[model samples]
Target chain A: MMTAQIKEFPGVGLRESDFEQRKVLYTEWVPNARYAWDAGVAIGRYLAELKEGRLIGVRCRHCRRTVIPPRVFCEWCFRPMDEWVPLPDTGTVNTFSLCYVTWDMRRLTEPEIPAVIDIDGTHPPVGILHLLGEVEPQAVQIGMRVQAVWKPPEERTGSILDIRYFRPVREG
Target chain B: MTRKVAIVGIGYTGCRPLTAEVSYKELVYEAAVKAYEDAGLDPRRDVDSFVTVAEDFIEGTSIFDEYTPDQLGGMLKPNVTIPGEGIHGLATAYLQIASGLVDVVVVEAHSKASNVLTLPHITAYAMDPVYNRPLQANPIFIAGMEMNRYMWATGATQEQCAQVVVKNKRCALYNPTAAYGANLEIDDVLAAEMVAYPLGRQEISPHADGAVVLVLAAGEVAESLTDLPIWIRGIGWCNDAPSLETRGWGRAIYAEGAGKMAYQMAGIRNPMEEIDFAELDDTYAYKELQHLEALGFCQFGEAGILTAEGVTEPGGALPVNVSGGNLGCGHLLDAAGLRAVVEVVLQLRGEAGSHQLPDVETGLAFGWRGLPSTSGAVVILSN
Candidate 1:
């Protein structure tokens, strides 16, 4: 677990008089958990397929195109996706950003760059978002070749985080 | 092309950092009920159509539109959702009424950011999953980059940026519903913890929970329903080129295009003079200044100095964000845009009370869909 040091603004002219100094307030307010049934079920099915070490893509029968991050329907044709096919994980980098921070607005000791890898083997390039580990931020170029780093079976969750990250694949 | 649309009724819940008493559904109902009562009509029967503004990622739920109808009393009607800013949703409703397809439309926008467990994680979902999120940079980093470029290109200083917060927070002191009201000084803003380089925590709009609803109808219907109907003279919306690397970082191209389209439609050539006041999306202090420059209120990089000159204050040449804007008032996502419209309506109807500006006849409300990409809306309102 990562923790950040909290810093507060010091007294400055008017603000010193207007607000209470050295005060912090935290409240626990939670909303009712409500899920959209159809969208929930669709994502559930997609996760189930990922656990078996097989990449799945939802195929739009009408357009004969496969969509990654599996959608219930094709955006263009407005037709239901009837077939699911295995996809190749190898892909090229389309675009990337080098992040030097963490999730909670805290600066990370070591920076990491997250990239959107477009898998090469599928038509229209099945793109999956994941971290780019063991790669220097400056060396990350558009269209760079990369492959997935799968987690051990015991550590896999039915979630996108199951893939630890994608690393560069050396050419022979 | 046929019917002229006017806003007959409007209602807004108070902006707060957190509303612990109510659920998201209950908050929506409160605003919708107030709007219905103000219009003197039944939400079930009188409302012919419904439009809601929300994004699946922001709300932490997918297909969020599915559960919204029950709260707004639009159980089964011609209802649709726009997964963008609230002003874009309003523009869609306005066009529907103008086409004579719908006689009356009810638009609702709400936000419960307090409920989200991790806001940064939710914001990460908005990035182009393949490339942008991999950077692991928080969304505020983008604001930092934008501010850095704006200063580099226009020669604005960090002090000028800090001054915007000082002025707006002071203006908010007079606004009863403003959540972050303070008698802040530039030094206070500068001394505050820095979230991103050149962008302090005070410069950003605080996350908030609230809702806003508006009832719009054709001119004939509005005239018969209320004595003071705020006319929608023109509406325009546009999106910028998505890639941050390629787009102009210093200037708001999206806002410029939308403002021009709206001003052209409203037949107003000189916006700085003709317009009484304006409500701009001030999610960040720099954004307020950046948008003002883009709206042709001032030249690029001049907005920071113009704001420091008190030009945007209540008694200044053009009072901007009289309702305290998103900075003073807490930011409520989709509701932020409609809240601006509500303020304009209140001012036009002589109902803004203490925060009201002088001789307000026509006002412009601008909304920007922040971060990852730029999307914006500009609407002209007249009494």
Candidate 2:
């Protein structure tokens, strides 16, 4: 038998009755922690290219890995990414999720098929997460070919949303 | 020369869906008082320093460290705050004791998850603003995609993942502090509302509020404080990648790295045979299987099979989450890891009344900083 023992375990749980009846004193306040994040050199150029309906990745000399949604420094090599590489807008669905709920846990009438798409010109598995369309939810499979469907050129806002979503690439 | 460390005392306030009677501070204070009394030490006289685990965003307050000292008897003392899991805080306390700068260090971690009305939006803030955040989706989508990739890579079925929920929640029926214990079936999980593909509302751990405080002392001090000091055999923590674009989708690289580090320290070559049981982080059900593989308890894809065979049951060869994991006992944000520690300490000391296992020796506890973070920590403990 264990020699030591706890005499009392103290933790008061709030019952639903008490909470609903306003039995507990409470104060609510919100703190604003907003920021205009600096996109730096690589991401700055990447977002700029997105406005023109294209994709770019930064290539590291040391690691020989082209990182998309580019960064100036290679996280693995601890060196600057010195080269810019152009990437295709098409890729495969590495993985996907059909979300029936919104960001705040609200139910949605239509499900959102979010997928990590392996853009054709970038390295394997280094993919962007975007919604999938032009297919049934059950039809979406891992390794399925997909092509980015961009928003109209005038609708481009230098954001990831510039590419509306990814659609299955039908073979000829 | 470095000294050995031991967990001298432990105290916790809950595993409840909501701790409304007391504020988060009162919750910590109560737990701290219990811990100090258990160790037979006074905060001002015997304690040397303090370490707390919390996140500014989760707490809905900036510089949360400054708000904690009043509750943990840490005012005017050397207090340190880590915005990670509770085991990470424990690791910090271990360093202080091992450094010989402090003979007794107190560590605290808590979760007031119910207080946050905007959890998803706040969690969305963790996404890569310029690249990922522009999509304006909830962070839960990341977990859904990961689960899909893990299942694809490991051949583990969704039904197998549901078994974990059944096992853990059923186990929670016997635990006093657990909140969400239930006799659930895999079909119930499958038939539940789907939040994301292959991830259901039933499979995800719901939030809870709790507080845990631990007392740590090294070598002679540990020997003087408690007769049943649970010795810390090894500790490890690691991070893989912060970006969703760069991380490995199929495996938990961070857990694998952390397990290797802790095993090397504890001289454990075969974790499957050496460690008696584990309380791994299961914020998501698939994570339990993924971590089991990463921790060397089983080969990749073998965890689901082993779990199906009852190998991880309390009566089986290697019990896992017998105290009811976060799935069974509600998820306690930053404090969840410490709650797992409380279970480990109880089992190691033979004080776990209804949940105690026989002839147990070495035990393991693991914690992961959930969502958009690959950081994980592992600690090995023994009687």
**What residue pairs are clashing in model 1?**
A99-B135, A113-B134, A114-B134, A114-B135, A115-B130, A115-B134, A116-B130, A116-B131
| lDDT by residue (tens digit), candidate 1, A1-172 | 1234536555654554344553433223233344322223346666876666557777876776777876554544434568777787778988888787888888876777788888764567768888897787778888889988888888887778778888988878
What are the chain A TM-scores of the candidates, in order?
0.76, 0.84
Docking category of candidate 2: incorrect
Among these predicted structures, which one has the highest lDDT?
Answer: 2
Share of reference contacts kept by candidate 2: 0.00
Give per-residue lDDT, candidate 1, residue B364.
91
lDDT by residue for model 2 (B31-50), tens: 88789888888786788999
- Against the true structure, candidate 2 reaches a TM-score of 0.69
Give fnat of each prediction, in order.
Answer: 0.00, 0.00
Identify the runs in model 2 with alpha carbons over 4 angstroms from their true place.
Answer: A1-172
What tens-digit string does per-residue lDDT give for candidate 1 at B1-383? 56899999887887888776666766776788789889877777788998999987666667988867766768777889888788998998999999999889999999888877677766655666555656767887888999999889888888888877887778777777778888888899999999988899999999778899899999999999999999999789888887766778988899999988988889888889889899999898888888998988888888888888889888999999888888888788888889889989999999888887877899999998877668999899999
